[model samples]
Target: MVNFDDKRNFYRMLLNSEVKVTIIDDEINSEFVATCRDLSATGMAIEMSHPLEMGTRVKAKIESANASVQALDVKGKVVRIEEEATDLYLVGIAIDDMD
Candidate 1:
């Protein structure tokens, strides 16, 4: 048996924390509670109850405080979506801006 490593620009860290995901569009503006599955400097993977369309711009905020920071806010775009289970979707977001 052989194992192959994934080729990625940035390393991803596994995180199972709850974060707020907001999608603001001309037609609709809504927010959803999502779980952050993995996080990297450039992007993150989140699991949400609803599926967001590809190319959708979103805002993600981490409210919980860690040893280093109090909170974090970032602007991202939806890059990919995968159905994890019934009524659940895993979304891949590319970070555009960070604050």
Candidate 2:
């Protein structure tokens, strides 16, 4: 028997603070707003009103006024999605590139 587990290269920080997020999908030529749930060096989890399909390539810009961090603009792919409630979803994005 063989076992393999998904591992992360960076540490994740619990960030409950509200931050502005702009998600852009070039394939659909659409963009939307979302809120950040948590952040890490490699990725971040976000709460979005609209559900994005898994594997969607996106460009995102995250801006925060919190004293601990600075703004981030990156391109990533949607890796996972979980429904938290009606019309709300939790999205996991894997950071691919940074600007």
Candidate 3:
């Protein structure tokens, strides 16, 4: 059986994301505390305080922060978003491979 929706869906992507991701921008910017919903080599799902818009570039420090998936600090940009209730958003960030 051929499924059109499944073939074109990006939601089916597999990720090994870690929780407890630390969002760090410049000194003038306050850090955003988030959790990893899923993770890939290039990106991760971060449930953040704000619904970060797509294309917004930011830096992140991959720490268990308090959880178990303690990743190294990384750089990346927002590529996608998922709305979950009010005042909360599921953001998919594509971490920049370079520092």
| lDDT digits (tens) for residues 1-99 of candidate 2 | 112343666667776555444456554557667777877778878887878889887777767577798777888888999999999899998988988
Name the candidate, 1 or 2, with the larger TM-score value. 1
For model 3, residues 26-77, the per-residue Cα lDDT tens digits are 4565465566666556776777667875777777665554566655667788
Q: On residues 34-93, what C-alpha lDDT tens digit does candidate 1 reach at each position?
A: 999988899999998889889999999988666776677999999999998998899999
Residue 87 shift from truth in candidate 1, angstroms: 0.8
The whole-model C-alpha lDDT of candidate 2 against the native structure comes to 0.75
List per-prediction Cα lDDT, in the order shown: 0.86, 0.75, 0.64
- lDDT for model 3 comes to 0.64
Ranking by lDDT: 1, 2, 3
| Model 1 regions lying over 4 Å from their true place | 1-4
- Candidate achieving higher TM-score, 1 or 3: 1
Reference-based TM-score of each model: 0.87, 0.74, 0.62
Output the number of the lDDT-best candidate.
1
